[model samples]
Target chain A: METLIFDLDAKPLREVNQFLHGDASGLNGKAFVIENPNGAHSIAVGLKSDIHVTVKGHAGYYAAGMNQIAKVTIEGSAGSGVAENMMSGMVHVKGFASNAAGATANGGLLVIDGDAGLRTAIALKGADVVVGGSVGSFSAFMAQAGNFVILGDAGEGLGDSIYEAKIFVRGKVKSLGADCEEKTMNPEDRKILADLLAKSGHAGVNPDSFKQYGSARTLYHFHVDNAGAY
Target chain B: MSEQQPKIPQTKPRFSATFDESTMSEIRRAAATGIYDIRGAGAKRKVPHFDDLLFLGASVSRYPLEGYREKCATDVVLGARFAKKPIHLKTPVTIAGMSFGSLSANAKEALGRGASAAGTSTTTGDGGMTQEERGHSSILVYQYLPSRYGMNPDDLRKADAIEVVIGQGAKPGGGGMLLGQKITKRVAKMRCLPEGIDQRSSCRHPDWTGPDDLEIKIAEIREITDWEKPIYVKIGATRPYFDVALAVKAGADVVVLDGMQGGTAATQEVFIEHVGIPILAAIRPAVQALQDLGMHRKVQLIVSGGIRNGADVAKALALGADAVAIGTAALIALGDNDPHLEEEYQKLGTTAGAYDDWHEGRDPAGITTQDPELMKRLDPVKAGHRLANYLAVMTMEAQVIARACGKSHLHNLEPEDLVALTLEASAMAKVPLAGTNWIPGVTGF
Candidate 1:
């Protein structure tokens, strides 16, 4: 595979993105390295080809947003909404991530080695997220579909108003929001959890140590009893 | 009869002014059901609207052009500020966004065909873009809403223009509600939700919030589409002056302001009627915001809500709006609430013109239902023809008024050519009262 290198200090981010958005046939199966990111916003966003991208330094908001068929890795801490609305791609953050990581992603795999900020995986639609470290409050709120694996402690209001998405947490959960509750982890749940753990480079972690949580199915329809919950 | 009813003084069985029959009925219904009443369409309550304004035709001081002989241009160009390719329309009237789940696929197709034949644009709504609308519409504006359902970069790139929806006129602070009945198999698949689930769209975008953040969000979108498509920011008519100014600052190529009368698919009836200000009261402040920023015409303004005819279009333009959009009227043009469906409407316990239970998915007109049988009743070609005819009539009517005002183009109409019939209209529209030189709030007057 050919390797392409771009220095953010010398070249504008726009040129890099435009080059990446080139014809899929020529860009696919290639490796691109972004040096000296310096926390710029919207870097490597809207990628649609099967390429690999590595950000050498800290990145800002919406890095790799709405990404498709691409794998992106950030070596340093990322700002808010990293990999937001991603579809069918993989995003890995080697350092801590800010708020709303992987928000509203329809399909993707997001792995965070360090702690994640508030509202992680919110409104997630058919995506898989694995955080090796702890996560902030309101994680997985209103998540529609997919699976989330948390290896460390979860902050308050984990999985609020969650839908069919399955959440596996190894550590203590401070609280659960309305319509969210613990569930019995079956063999299928264990299998999926193990697969996600392996795919996110946590193959040695024990799926049995994690507890599964999901929607209680009470707030699916409007009812007077659930008014307080709303 | 023998004693003239004993000369009894009857009070004429008067109804209370505060609690009218409609109010009492609503209270009774609320007492019966714990949930707030949810319905479709715009505010039913009457407010000061276009009917309160009148055009001042040329007579002595101004010269009037021959209506049939002179050409009164109605063309409009939107998003000329930053877009590589702006939208050009033969008429200033466009179709407002209505979601596919709220309306049938045939209805969406018809709207596209109609708007295309009329040489205008049509917009997609909260449920996201559908192929029916995309394939048929000559100019399609895709909505990037809070829910992000069916939102993708490919579709964003395919759109002629992109509209970022901050809020809707019917329920500004509230999210959208598509009841379980409307979430059919196709609808559920499109939204990526379970079958028959009550889908509530979020009120705010998941990625960003506030005007400062909005600027970055717009930039992100622009980067995604390579700045090829125009970006529009849409807001409900709450604080039009501040909101429009902020949208402009946030790098919008066009600003869409929808007033209280703008229709919704499903929302709390109370929120729809009480939340936002009327379009008649919203246009001037928004236009003033553009003028204050020196962006008038440079950044086009599209106002919607109860814009029924050419007269309303003319009035909106005179008040400084570049164009007008129609939702409920367009639905009507496609045969919603037709008197021909009176029997079916009666079965649904409503009259033809008064039927508004669109959330139930039992539309007799087949325009707002997901039922295959009901949807088949509407022929896209015929409905599209009707809409085209209606649009043509509206364009001609606006041209007539513009010619009568001695203006060669619809955009040439100014506030000086209009007067308010009532004090409320005068203050809201910033126009002088008829037969007097008094504009209620203009201190110089």
Candidate 2:
């Protein structure tokens, strides 16, 4: 297959993403490498396809926003709000992504290679996010239904205000939300994490070291006893 | 820097609308009808108007202090409940956050100098803290927005206060937009963007969301700053009850509410005129929420948006605001609303009273205008003095109103001392209407 490489040196995000995923006018079914993707916003936003993309540099907020079907990988530092409300396919980050990555995502797999800033996977409804590194404080906040896996140390106040979402962490967790608690890392979590890692091409991860973090199922609907925390 | 009002140029006559031949015909035709000229959809309904409220004078029961003589202090201590040491502000009137990238460095310097002279604090906007601002300001508040542009460790340590901005009043859920024109080379480098490119701010913070995460975030910031500076959480005036309660619980020392009229560096016109509740409607609910949580007055409340003068400050306090923040008015003091720049204003397709093209960066007075020539029109030192004078005047005005209400401090102005001239203001501000007690429409609310 013929591959198209984009120079990310000052190329407008809209212009670049337009050529990547905007129908036949874009690089349809062709592999593309984007280098020096510094501070570009919404790169490959709203993509729905079967093409492969690799970002070589840092990304700004809302990278791969509302992405679907296509595979997107970021290689450098990412600002807050990456891959927000994504529906399908896979979005991978090789470097640290800032807060609120995969926020309110419905479906799709978001894989981070490095540490994520605060508010990881906040309000996630139904997306599968796998972080290769640790997440900052408040991961999986108000999450409804999703699988969030953190490979590294989770920061303070993790899973705060969580809702029905399952989280897996390899390192120490600082805190848990009202409805969240440490859970049994059953075969399901292990299998899922392993599978996501394999799909995102990081087979080096050992799933057994990771523990399961999830909702405590106590403060889901706001009871009187749980009112103190809120 | 002394508390004395300077003589303003009164060159223009006390005349009303003076539209030229073509615009006058349209105005006349519109006025020919019995009804007022129709505007956007939101205008027709009985939303609260600011003109509806009036302050009651000092009565026999309450002793009014000397407006010009007595030292009714405008100084305040914020972050007392949470921080080990609270910040002692010189004046209750604070400068609202405006970014260096959005405003010129000279303008930012002026704000800092003016606020310092006036004994108030100036704030940084979405952009990171600049040395010029820090040098000029006696007390500086650094803003932490979702974008995290130019954010680093050094500036964070230097800041007197850290304001974690969740949203603004102008467009509550809306993000920051710096038009292409404003993104100069200096701005681009600071924000890590290409020069002259239109930039959009992120709506969500990079790290965490919700109070639980916010608590951790706050702790991190505190640790980074060695818990020296006070932390403030700024939210748009939406769901104040929940937001304030959450912010307080999340360890915010101060809660800032920005109302609908809050200024934006640049936003869609549709978003600005619409979105977010008014400051008037937001204060009471927030106060009630705080009181319910037993955190009332414990967590300081600073209100912003549509605040024009000292009267507005007095009213905001009476309605439960602990302090008032001004963005547009501060710019006005720095030569924003100068009628003297009327001729230059015409070329920009906006008159002195009607100009909202802050995003265009073509300000004639050098405050909002980003043009090199226009910016040269301003002298930072003189502008700073003007701003300082304005702050003192506002502070005095608040003191005068406080004394009339039999209160010593600005925060002592209570809800009972105020009466509303209109029904909407009565409902929004939680005050009784004058003449008769009935608040016109909100019988059920």
Candidate 3:
């Protein structure tokens, strides 16, 4: 496979983005290596085609934003909104992620290998998120539709105002947010978790260790009794 | 015996000013339902508006042109500040943003068709862009709201312009709410939420907190679109002076100012009535801010809220706005709350003119509902024609006014030709009262 190398210290971000955005069809299915990203903002944003991009170092805000039909792997820590609004692609962060790691993404898969910061997957639409470690407070806030798998502990206020999205956690939980509570894990849920773990490259882990959480379905209609929750 | 007693004149029954009938009814309804009343539309309470301003037709000092012979220009160009391609409109009136979830697909299509026919731009609201709108509209402006629902880069590039909405006039600092009943499968899918669930949009954007961050956000949008589309910053009329100045400093090509009289799909009644300033009080301050920065007319201003007729449009242009946008009026022109639907409206426990329960998704006129049966009642083609006809009439009416004012173009109608009827209106519009050279709160009256 043809490989392209971009050294951030040697070239300006605009120059690299210009080349990347410009007709990259010749390098279809090729690998792109980015060195010294060094927590820069908006690196590899709006990538539309199917290709492989590997960032050798830490990436900054909105890294791999609006990604579609591409595979992006970050080797080091990632800043806020990594893989935001992604559609039909995969983004794997090998290290810790900052806040709002997949905010408002409609379709895609985001895999975080380390601890995720606050509000991870806030307003996430259909992106499947798998966090390998613990997450901060307000994880999965207002999540609509998706599967969020947490392998470790969770902080407070998880899944506030949550909708149809399902949450599975293997470790301890701090507390649940409004309209969110623990749900019984059935065989179908176990099967879904097994598939998610397999897709996230954690197939060795047992699915029986996880607990499921989702919306209580009480806030679907307006009622005066629920005014305090609002 | 009762008929005989009624023949004599009796003293008129006195009513309580503090606890009126409407107030007592509201209390009773709240006690019975145990929830605050939620509805659509703008404030019903009267406020100072463009109706308070009158134009002085030319008599001697100003020469009036022949009504049919004079050529009055109504063309307006927007976003010439930085964009390579700016918007050119045949008329100064454009359609304001109303989301797909808040309105039916047919309604959006009709709006696109009408705006295209009128040679003006139509905007996408909170939910995001729809194919029906893009396919039919000749010029479409995409709104970037705090919710960021269904926002993607591809659509941003496809848009003719981008409007970053900081606030709307109906609820300045409040979040938007879509009740569960209106959240159909398609709306939910577009918004990335569960079907039939109440969706609450955040009041503030997650990324930027202030003007400094706003600059970066605008830059990012510019980069995404390759600096092609014009960016507009929209704010509710709270502190128009400061907001307009800040938006200009943040590198906006256009500023959209919405006043408190603006209509909303759904919001708390209290917030809608008592949150922001009137448009009459807002335009002068905004224009002053633009002048202070030496950007007046350079940075286009589009004002909305209570604009109804061509007279309102002419009055707005005189107040220094480049153009005017209409929301409630546009919906009305599309047959919303039409008298023909009076029988259906009565079944919902309200009259057609008084109906405002749009959030429930049971719109009989089919303009604001997602239900397939209700939506089918509206023919986009017919509705589009009606809207186009209404727009044509408004434009003609404005031209008549412009000719009477002896102005060759609608933009030439200045505040000097206007006179206010009340002290408050005179101060708000910064114009003198009729038959008097004195303007209240300015100099010696």
Candidate 4:
């Protein structure tokens, strides 16, 4: 597996598609660089194989949206919807990511080096998005089954209208979202997050620094008096 | 109850009209045909809304901030450039996007003038940006609708910010529909469609289907503009938490949430009232989504629909909205349903308070009316100035409340500063009871 270099000056989209349009599936052993990323968004979207795509600088919206099975990483910040609707893959952001990172994702590991914007991992079916920093409010709203772990403070209304997804936060939450609630930290949570952190390269993080939140299943179905106002 | 055996009345009128002869005649005509009661919002009945949510005023516990003597910050920034410049508004209360085809050019320009005068922004609606509106408004936000009518590079580059109109509060899942009756020659040209064609704007973006595509679409937009403009995703307030998250994921610089009470030029009445959440209910979740991302204020959040006056603005801010946008209120300021048009409204078969027929284009007031005569009734200069005054008052009011709440800036208003008048208000506001600290935690407000 030879390393492929895509300089910022080079428009790799055509070439990258050349390989993808063909059958070059796994680019893991190769180091791909989108040099001087400078907010060039969507480096590799909808790539359905385990390839490694490293965006050197900032990438714009949906940096790696709906990624199927590729391991896509960005060196700098990512704009909104990084790894959106991603179906099974690994996405890493060395810097901050805009709102809704890993939204509606299923079966993937999304790691953000820094903070994430609002509604990160919303309605996540099975994706796991680990943030190195804080998250905005309503993170993981209506998330059915996934893990959203935040290392920094959580914004107001965290986890409102969530489903069965698990949320672990190391920081303070301004408020909880409608129908979302704090749950008792069980041993399963501790083990799962610890293993996840180690696998995602945050091996030494203190698991105790996090708290878990999820839906109480009260607002999912509307009641006349308790009709879901949202 | 039927013991009296009410005899079947002979074929006559549906009922005797209690209204005057003219009103009866109009009703008879409407009955003889069809298509009556053509307005927006809760046609079934009225409810106390943001309009009814009044402030407690200066009292023993609070002091009134000077209306004009004090330094009240009203500036608001929205949308990071996708390829261009971010939008900068004079006040937090912006005029929401209302289409050009749906409204007369003078009316659109009036909104821009009014918004500019008050030092705020006015947004373009489903119909792409109009040069007249843009030239008039200091801060003009161009909207990209599902229809994509008149969309091209020049307008995209010219806009301060671009709003991706995924949905609206009035009819979230529906698209822009201009009945053939409303389609004019100029509208046809601007839209690049034949004149007098009933345009059923695609309910969804013709090119992009899901969020994944939207992400690319947003990037393409950025590329087209050379990364100088900010992108905003405007969603009708339905499943706000998820939508907010999706919007954030979509890389929106701002997430604009429009509530159920939002105004629509043309949409099914049922959809307007039956679908979507209220602006009050939508704010907390949206703010929370930002907070969850650790980008609450960093990725600005603007809320609209049912926002009226200073108190509603303050409440939205306190509830976690970075800024507020108004459509109907701005229209009212431009004389949408002025009582002065009462007789004319009667002729239109609607009352001032009962008006909802924005789609008819027969508005006696120039606000929503497209009739040349009706549009002429509203002097753009005068109406524009009036809108400015009203916007100023709203900004002042928000600032005063924020100051009283001990925050120097309007955006600093928070849930801690408010108490709800009713449990419904309290719950919707996500605030505690007026006299109690307890929120039904288990039930969850």
Candidate 5:
């Protein structure tokens, strides 16, 4: 496949995005590289082709947001909301990510090699997130459906008001929010954890060491007893 | 008979003013059910609304145009600020956002068809865009809500305009709640939740928060759609002045302000009635915010909530609103709360025009239910025609008022052409009281 290179210093981010949003039939199965990103916001966002994108440097907020059928890789740190609302494909962050990484994503694989900031995978919908390092508070606050695999420690209020989404943490959890509780890991949970770990390049990690967490099913229907939790 | 006729002092049976019958019943209901009362529709209590304001027709100082001879234009253009293609409508009245889960598919299609036939726009709500609405609506504004349910880039690109919902008028600080009964398989699958689960939509967007962050968020959307589709920011009427100004500051091409009278599918009754200000009190402050920013017409303002007729549209425009949106009224035109369904409503333990239990999914009108049998009762074509007729009547009525006020276009109507019947209305509408040059809030009139 021929590689296409675009320098952010020469061309505007808008031009790059517009080019990426061009006819998917012609642009699919191609490799593109973005140079001198300089933490620009909305880089490679809304991509809908089966193309590969590589960001050489740090990216700003919403990098590759609402992405579909595209593979995006950030070699350096990323700002907030990296790969937010991603529909399908993979987003690999080589370095630390700021707040709300992979927020509200419906379907995707987000691999963050370093620590993630607050509210990572918040309201996550059917996406799989793998974080190699620690995550900040309120991560997966209202996650609906998906799998969140954390190899490191989790901050306060992990999986608050979660629904159906499975959370696997290898390290200690500071606390669990309302309607969230630790659950016994079954064979299916183990398989899902192992698969995500392998795909995110954490193949050496043992799935058995991780503890699973999920919704308690108490807040599914409103009751007076759950008023305090609300 | 003589003994029974002995003198007795007659007294009338009186009830407590504070503890009215309605209030007592609500208290009893709450005691019986531990959960708070949840219902649909807007505030039932009366507030100072459009009826409180009157138009000042031309007589001596101003010249009035001939009714049938002169043309009173009602056309409006929205999102002219940044969008490559702005929306042009024949009439200034549009349909407000109503979710598919809250309303049946037939109802959604009818709204789209009616709005299209009338040459106006209709909006999608929290549950995300449905194919029925998109296929039927000539101009569809897709809502980018907090929940992000069924939100995708493809749909975003397909929309004529995008509205980022910050809050709703019925429950500003609160999130949306679709009870388990309404969470059918389709609704559940679209929302990515389990079937029969009561879905709770978040109050804030998951990705970003605050105005500064919102600016970047809007840019992301613009980049996604290539700046072709207009971007609107919608806010409930809590503090309209601040909210509208902030929405503009956040790079909104249009600002939609929904007042307290806006309807909700399901919300706490207390929150619906108590939270947010009335549209009558909200329009001026929102317009003032736009004027202060020097973006009055550049950034269009769409006001909604209790806008029932052409008079209300005229009043909203006179107070500086570019256009008006209707929700409850549109539902009414589609046959909600029709007296023809009175017998069925009685079986549901409520009377026609008093039925607001939309969350129960037992709608007699078939407009707010997911039941196949109930939904089949509503014919999209017929309901669409009814809505189109209503829209035509409203536009003509507003044209009549505008012609009487010596204005050739509905947008030309100014605050000087209106007066308030009560002090509250005078202060809220910022118009002078009838028979006197006194606006209660302003220093001088």
Candidate 6:
């Protein structure tokens, strides 16, 4: 495998991104190692190829944002909006992630080994997010369609104004938001959780330990009775 | 039988303030339908606009240029602040953002074609950029709205510029609403919403909270595009001074200020009429904000809403706007609400030139519907030619006014060359009254 090394301290963020931009489809089947990131923002943004990127140090805001068909691994903590609007790819964050981890993403798989900050999956359309640790408040706000799995406890007001997206949390929940409630996980959910756990490398966790949460569907249509909720 | 009847004094129609026909009809409709009336277009009520101000042609103090022989330049450059590639347009007037879903694909394509022909730019509205628009438009500005519907990074890269829409003038603080009938299968897929369901876009951005967050967001977008494209911040014409200042502070290369007369695909009528300030009132404050920041011309200001004809364009430019965008007028040029479609319009319980129910998707002009047959009726090539012709006429008309005012360039026409006809307009525009040397708030006692 061809490996490319980029030291952020030696080169500016734009220079490094320019190199990546120039390589577009040429980076396929190649690996890139970004060293001394120093919490640099917007690393690997708008990357579209099926390349493997490993950031050795912590990343600033929007790390690997708008990634498509690429495999990215963030070895340290990530700032806000990691993997935002990712179309089809896998982003593995080894440590904690700041707020809005996967905002408005369409399709992707994001696996966070540590805790995720508030509004983790806000407006997520169709992405599967698996968190090893707890997620902060307002997780999955206005989520339309996706599968969000949390291994640990969830913070307050989870899944507010949620739609068809399913939430499976293993630990205790603080509270649910408007029109969101706990639901029993049937066999189908267990199978999906099993698959997601295996993919996220958390197969040791018990699928049966999780509880499912979803939209109450009351606010789907406009009615005067539900006006207060809006 | 031939007795002369006493001719009673004819009682004139006395209009009521509280129980007017419009108010009564609105109450009746609301009571019957349980939901507020949602329609397209802008405020129907007349307000202060560019027409309130007129130019005094050069006679003795200033010398007029020869009409056809003299050069009257109209070129404008946008986003010179920080963008690597700024937009250079031949004309100061451009087509404003009107989405593919709200308008037909044909209409969007027509706008792109017309703008491209005129050497200007067209913009993508609430929905994302369509292939037809991208292909036809030589320079296209992609809007980053609060809804985030159809927002994708690839398109952001493809765009010549990015406009972060904070608020629309028609409904300043309100969100966008697309009714069930307009959301076709394609639109549904693009927006990630259910088919045939009412789609209400959120007014607030999911990621950011306030101005501070907006700064971060702008930085992020700049990073996404690698600072190759210019970033514009569009605000509704309310609190223009503060909003423009904040946008410039947030690292915007351009600012788009839209007045209440700006049109929308679907919005509450109450919000449209009572929400925002007029374009005439908004331009000066926005320009002042830029001037205060010491970046007036550095960061281009584009004003929209009720901009029609050459005089309106010249007035806006004289008030310190670098460019003026057109939405409602553009649609009209594209054959929306044409009188020739009177029969079809009447069948929809509305008449031509008064049809505002664009959300109903029964437009006879085939400009604002997703219905396949109706959409097919609008030929992009023909409509594009018509729009180009209209733009040409507007440009020539502005040239005539500029020549008469002794200004060689449109930007050379300053506030000193204009005078307001009414006190309200004089106060709002900060220009002298027509027959007096006094401005209402400035020199007048």
Best by DockQ: 5
| Per-residue lDDT over B238-257 for candidate 1, one digit per residue giving the tens place of the 0 to 100 score | 99999999999999999999
What candidate 4 gets wrong by more than 4 Å, as runs, is A1-230, B1-38, B41-70, B80-84, B442-445
- lDDT head-to-head 2 vs 4, winner: 2
DockQ of 5: 0.88
Question: What level of docking quality does candidate 4 show?
Answer: incorrect
- Residue lDDT tens for model 5, B1-445: 4567677987888899999999999999999988899999988889999999999999999999899999899999999899998999999999999999989999999999999999999999878889999999999999999999888788898899999999978888888999998889998888899888888999999889899999999999999898898999999999999999999999999999998999999999999999999999999999999999999999999999999999999999999999999999999999999999999999998999999999888897889998889999899999999999999999999999999999999999999999999999999999999989999979476
TM-score of 2: 0.63
Which stretches in model 5 have alpha-carbon errors above 4 Å?
B1-5
Clash counts per candidate, in order, are 0, 13, 0, 49, 1, 0
**Per-model root-mean-square deviation over C-alphas:** 1.6, 19.5, 3.3, 18.0, 1.2, 2.4
Residues B68-167 of candidate 2 have per-residue lDDT tens digits of: 6766667788888767667888777899999987788889999999999988889998768888899999899989887666664457767889999999
Per-residue lDDT, model 2, residue B306, is 78
How far residue B245's Cα lies from its native spot in candidate 6, in Å, is: 1.2
- Superposed by TM-score, candidate 6 places the C-alpha of residue B85 at a distance from the truth, in angstroms, of 1.7
Q: Please, what are the lDDT tens digits per residue for candidate 4 over residues B369-389?
A: 556777788888999999999
Q: Candidate 2's residue-wise lDDT over A11-42, tens digit each?
A: 65546665654565455677778877776655
Off-target runs (Cα >4 Å) in candidate 1 are B1-6
Could you give the DockQ of candidate 3? Answer: 0.44
Ranking by lDDT: 5, 1, 6, 3, 2, 4
Model 3's CAPRI class is acceptable
**Model 1: what is its DockQ?**
0.74
Indicate the docking level reached by candidate 6: medium
| Residue pairs in collision within model 1 | none
All candidates: DockQ = 0.74, 0.05, 0.44, 0.03, 0.88, 0.55
**lDDT (C-alpha) at residue A117 in model 1:** 93
Q: What fraction of correct interface contacts does each candidate retain?
A: 0.52, 0.08, 0.38, 0.05, 0.85, 0.37
